[model samples]
Each structure stands twice: as structure tokens, then as C-alpha cells.
Target: MPSSSATATVTTNVFEAGKYTTVLQKVESRTTCCPANTSPPPPVPPPKPLLIVMPCEAGEFPLLVFLHGYLLYNSFYSQLLQHIASHGFIVIAPQLYLVAGQDSSDENKSVTATTNWLSEGLHHLLPPHVKPNLSKLGLAGHSRGGKTAFASALEKAATTLKFSALIGVDPVDGMDKGKQTTPPVLTYVPHSFDLDMAVMVIGSGLGELKKNPLFPPCAPNGVNHKDFFKECKGPASYFVVKDYGHLDMLDDDTEGIRGKSYILSVQEWEVQGADEEIYRRSCGCIYESILGR
Candidate 1:
């Protein structure tokens, strides 16, 4: 874990460099996440819920940690979450309750604690016959949640926990270095996040990307994927879907006639020209690299 004046520890990984094999194929025995061998320290994955839906065959599956945006609940992301879960990996989505008078510091602590507990608690939940070891694991979040995940990675307390990749669905804030602190070190990390697989899907909300106040303005023309992905740095790459509004990711909203769609609030959206396939591909890519099968 690399620590700076403000070290952001997104230490989500616990597995060391080892042979590629399935936990489901071997005797089931997973107890704790490996300790950090680096500076600062990794941020412990939060504990919320881990729902696993395996593929037909049993092998080591990848993990995609889902994080919803602010003022939102994990339940809201159910469609996307379940879609990812059905793809044969473990899905961990930590709920961050935003109540009145909640302090950001306290709330973040809760987030980190929950993430830690979840990472450590995985092996115990498996049935004797089912051992879940994610070959590749990562995080994907939207709106403020996306920003939180992106910024959170920069501050992971543990210097050793590296995610395969990070997906920011039209992230806002944090990316902009401010007077308070410099942009985090995630932009400079190696491919340690992913053992073998790596893919970063960056989405710009049609509503915001068109004329986003936080992200680059995407009005008349549109914001480019590079604008957002460039900030991530490292072996990280990106993807952006046009025409889709921010709320399209949610099943609740109806698509617009032209390039518009009923908003799912100021967050979450379906990518332009992308039906549900984007979700499937998102899971597919992450799944492919994590397991190394």
C-alpha cells in the first residue's frame, strides 16, 4: 500500500500471486484476507451482502463489488447487481445509509469497515461443496458513489490491496484535485488490481456528459471518454456509451423518444445504444479476466 500526505487505501485484494485454480475445484478452506506487505495499508472491504450465483461449472469466479451513489440505496441498483451476480461471480454491494446530520468522516469509516468485513467474511459463507475464490475482483459505482469509489481507492489504508480495475459510471467530484488534497495515487497504480484480467468501463451520463457541470460538458457535441478515463491513470482503460441518460441503468425509467430518457434522479443511467448487453459485457469482461479460465 502506497501512503502519501493523504494516503487513500483501496486495499481490496487479499490474494497473493499464486497459481490459477478454482477454490471450488479444491478442498474448501478460506479463512482470512492476507495481511498487507506495503506501506500505509489497504482499506478493508466493507461488509454488506455477498450474493453468489455460480455458472454451470464450478471454478474460481471473479468478484465485482457494487457501490451505489449518494442518497441512494443498494436496492436501487438491484437490476444491475443481479445481472452481474447471475454471471457466475460473487457480488458484494455495501449499503451506505445517508441520514440527516451524518458526518462524511463517520460515514466513510462505516463504508471501509463494511468493505473489510465483507472481504474477510466471504469464505465462511460458502457451502462445504462451494468454495468461492475470485480470481479477479473490482469495484463499479455510479454518480457520487462512483466518485466515492474512485476517490476511496486513492485513500485505501492498506498499501497491498489492489483491485483488478475500477469502473466509474460518470463519476463526479474527487477527480478534481482541490485545495484540500492532491488527486490520489490510483492514477499511477500497476496492474496489481487484476491478476490477469483488466477492464475499466467509464460511462458518462447523457444528461451530465452532455452538459455535465462536474464532468466535462457534453452538450451540443458530447464529452469524450478520454476526459474521464485519463484521470484514472495506470493500466486502467475505459468505455463510454452515448445517448443513454444517467438513469437508464435503473429499470424504473422509460427511454426517451429522441436522445432523452426519464431520469432515475441525478444518478444512474442506461448507456446510449446499449441495451442490457452492456451490463452483460461488463460482467463478462470482469469475469473472464478474474478467473483466468
Candidate 2:
């Protein structure tokens, strides 16, 4: 477990969404020119209530499935997913509700099932000209969803669906033997997972500080990032962003209150200032390096 602080330096290259255009008009125009249009379009995927974001430019884009934090809505991460999609990757973020009685293990299974569904069925819904490369797949999540992402990867390794990379942004611990539990009372036990894929763990230096006092600290004792990073054995790297909170990596409208002030009402949010720049640069750097953009 080689953990280091902010002493390390990263060449900042911010990701600009305008660089790739996946607009509706252009996508429809390209669809007309697809060579494999002889066959009729397949039916839309079953109503599983999933959020899928795709790039406008036509090509065999890579596929990515994102898991959201426990209790947090999947659509909350739309901005982040859309930004990633603009870089030529198909992102699927599924909404999981623990409040509705779903556990971490249940959510983990949902992730795997969703990935399988995408691999086997999503192509039918896409434009004939726009084919997605299922082999080049990745799993990512925030908070507890990050833990679920890691768990899903382990589960996926057993089957035929293989993931090429895994990313966890300020992941929080909330599982016990594949079950879900909240903090202070439910302690998370780490497992020696054998993952054969590139791993990137992003942590925030101040994640636990800005958390609501009423609830337990988000990244208690660094279990969220450091613990997970240390356990990863194959092709793993860790990056810690100073002065950022757990919510900083999420989309602007994550909280139902809307706008940039919601985080402030409950706890101090670090979306502005250097934190935003670091977040964008780190996201771009990892995507480019992993997806070969």
C-alpha cells in the first residue's frame, strides 16, 4: 500500500466537451449513412429505468457503466457522465435506492446485470452506423457506489464479461460480506480481490471534514480511498486531491435542492476554486490514458 500525499505533481490538461460533437442533428445525419442499415431497427431496451449517455460522433465508442452512491440518484451524476461521453465513450449510470430497501449486495448484482444487458442488448437501440465496443469496458462509482463498482468487477471476472479498467472517486465504505450498512455501527471488511484491470482510485484530502456532523464522516479514517487503494494488487494507482470534499466529484445538481448552494446549506462544498480544476484535469487525464483517446 504505497500511499502518498499532494507532494506529487500532475500535468494539468483540462477536458473541453466542445472538442467532440455528439449533437442530435449530427448523430441523426450520420445514422442515415450507416452501411449496415438493411435490417430493421431493434426494439428499445426493456424498461429498467437506466440512464445512458452516448457520444454524438459516430464510431465504435468504448462502453462504461457507472454506479451512483447509496441513496443518491443516478441522474445526479449526469454532468460528469456527459463530460466523459463527449470524449467518445458510452456511459450507463443506473439508479440504485437503498432507501427503497436495496442493499449493497443487491446493488452490486444490479451493476453486473446492467452491464450484461448493455453488452447483449444496447446495440439494437443504437444507430446502425454507431457500434459500441463492448470489450473495452470500465466500471466507476462514487461513495458506496464506488465500493459496489469494485465488487461488481470482482463478480464480473468470474463470468465472460471483462472490464478493462475501474475508477473510484472518493469511495465510501458501506458493505459487510456483500451486505449494506451505514457508518459507526456497520464496519466494512476489506477483501483481497483479484482484479486483472487498470485501477485508479481518486481521494479527497478533506472529504471527512466537510461532512454533516449529524451523520458520520463520509470517509472515516480514510477507509474510502486509502484502504481500497492499498488492497488493489494489479495495475493500481492512487491520486489524492487536496482541499476537495466527497461531494465535489459529483454533478452540480446532486442534491435535490438544485444549484451550487445546496452543498453549502448542509456542509461546506468545494466545487469552485482549485478543486474544480483538479477534478476536471484528473478526469481527463485518466480517461485519455485508459481509453487511449
Candidate 3:
């Protein structure tokens, strides 16, 4: 269970690297079954590996299952994952799929499977003396992965583990609300989300703008972060970061030319009862910037 206090001390800049030393590990799934000699043998399934980033110290830390964006590899967020883990948390990022269609139902199911697998297989992969506190588990993603996180939390896919916090970074549901993909989550209604956990929706002011004329905006107007936040209930907060886009949160080393263009910094902390203070501080900072004070 999370701390009941509503406030936490902030001694350092949240944007900088945390105090703990972190380590990264990659775990590949190994098949235990052998194919029988039959007339028609079934094809073997591909391995779904996991990229784990956690503190190297001996202590219990909260766990967060982070999903990668559309057609993006989990390793693309290596720096971001290490940043969170350095703050005394364990981040488990799974390579859900190498390629996916418009439909995201399968991705939702994959997240569920990965979450359930933690209880049985995660301990074996972790470093000695490092413990994961499953009770404080959180679910978060970027872009399409954000939508999958929300869909999975809304019961679109069943899982035994309970997520205590939910976060969406520039999440988009297709081009608009009218053209939502499979297993749609947004209802286009204010405070309509049935999520029982604390929610945070981070938007990008530049995301709705097209980089060029040939393609649509990465995060469109009607089905973007604005829509996701408007439909959240209490214990929720929304932040719109100016001069950034949907892909800005990814690590600088992410593959492709666009990866070198921009970088966005974000800090991960426990989301039990400190959301209100964080929201208040964020609003104050925005106000000060606007007033030039």
C-alpha cells in the first residue's frame, strides 16, 4: 500500500538524475516445450523479451510496467527507464511486438500476459537483494502504448494484478475520436473513465501540429491528451508541455533521424497521495512562466 500522506519533500530538481545507481538487464524468453514428431508440427512462437531497469541497491522499490509506443522497441526508452529506476523504482518494459496493425486489442492482451508473468518469472531475472514491491505497481506508456495501457486498465484485457496509478504521455486514439481503433477507450464524455487509480495525462502543445503536409498530426485534436484528461475522474491531473511532440519523450538514441531532433525530460515518483501537490506545483510553475515572474 502507498503512503497516506498527501505531501512529500522535494529536496532536489525533479528533472535531473536521481540519487541511486541503476542497472539495466535484458531477459529473453526461453521455450521449455519440445515439438512432437507429428505429420504437421505447429510453428514455434517468437520470444517476447523484457528490458528491466532498476536500482542496484538492496531495498524494496515500487514496480512500473512501461509499454513502448507504436512500432517502437522497448530499448528505445532506455534512458527514460533508467531515470525512473534511479529514483528507487523498478521499471519493466516489454517488447510487446515488432510490428502491429491498426488494431490494438492484441497489444492489450500482451500487456496483461506480461503483468501476470511478473509474479512467476520476474524474481529470477532481478539482481540479488533487489526487491520489487508489487503492491505499488503502476502502468504507463507513450503514444499508442498509452492507449493500450488505458484499455488494459479499463478491463479491455483481463489481468490478476492491480495497477495503482495510470499515466498517458501524448496518447492518441487514431486520427480522431470518430475513427478510434479496435478496443477503443475514450467515450468523449467528461469524467467518464471508470479507472479507480490515480491518473496523469501529459500533453504536448506541438503534437497536434503537423511536421509536414504529407502526414496527419501525430497527436490529433479530437482524440489526443485533451480528450483523455477531460474524461478522467477525481485523483487525476493533466499537464501540457509546450514546444514538444508525441515522440519527444523517447530517448535521444532512439533509431531514425527524427530521434536526434528533440529531447523531453520527465521524472517518475510515487503516485500514492502526492498527486495534488505535484499538480499544484506544476500549475504554479506554468503561471509563473506565463506572467514572466
Looking at model 2, residue 26 earns an lDDT score of 11
Index of the highest-lDDT prediction:
3
Per residue, candidate 3 scores C-alpha lDDT tens digits across 51-166 of: 88887779988888888887778877776666566556788888888778988988987888888877767776676699888788888888888899899888833777888888
lDDT for 193 in candidate 3 is 91
Arrange candidates, best TM-score first.
3, 2, 1
lDDT of all predictions: 0.45, 0.63, 0.70
Residue 40 C-alpha lDDT in model 2? 44
Off by over 4 Å in 2: 1-14, 23-47, 98-102, 157-159, 175-191, 255-278
- Residues 68-186, candidate 1: write the lDDT tens digits: 65455554555455444444555566655534132244445444654555446555555445455543667666755664565555555632345666676655443233311123223
Model 2 per-residue lDDT at 187: 35
Higher-ranked by lDDT: 1 or 3: 3
* Residue 137 shift from truth in candidate 2, angstroms: 0.5
How do these models rank on lDDT, best leading?
3, 2, 1
In model 3, residue pairs whose N, Cα or C atoms come closer than 3 Å (at least 3 residues apart or on different chains), thus clashing, are none
TM-score winner between candidates 1 and 3: 3
User: How many residue pairs collide in each prediction?
Assistant: 40, 1, 0
Please report how far candidate 3 places residue 33 from its true position, in Å: 12
Instruction: Tell me, by TM-score, which candidate is best.
Output: 3
Off by over 4 Å in 1: 1-58, 100-107, 159-161, 174-201, 209-227, 252-293
TM-score versus the correct structure, for each prediction: 0.57, 0.76, 0.78
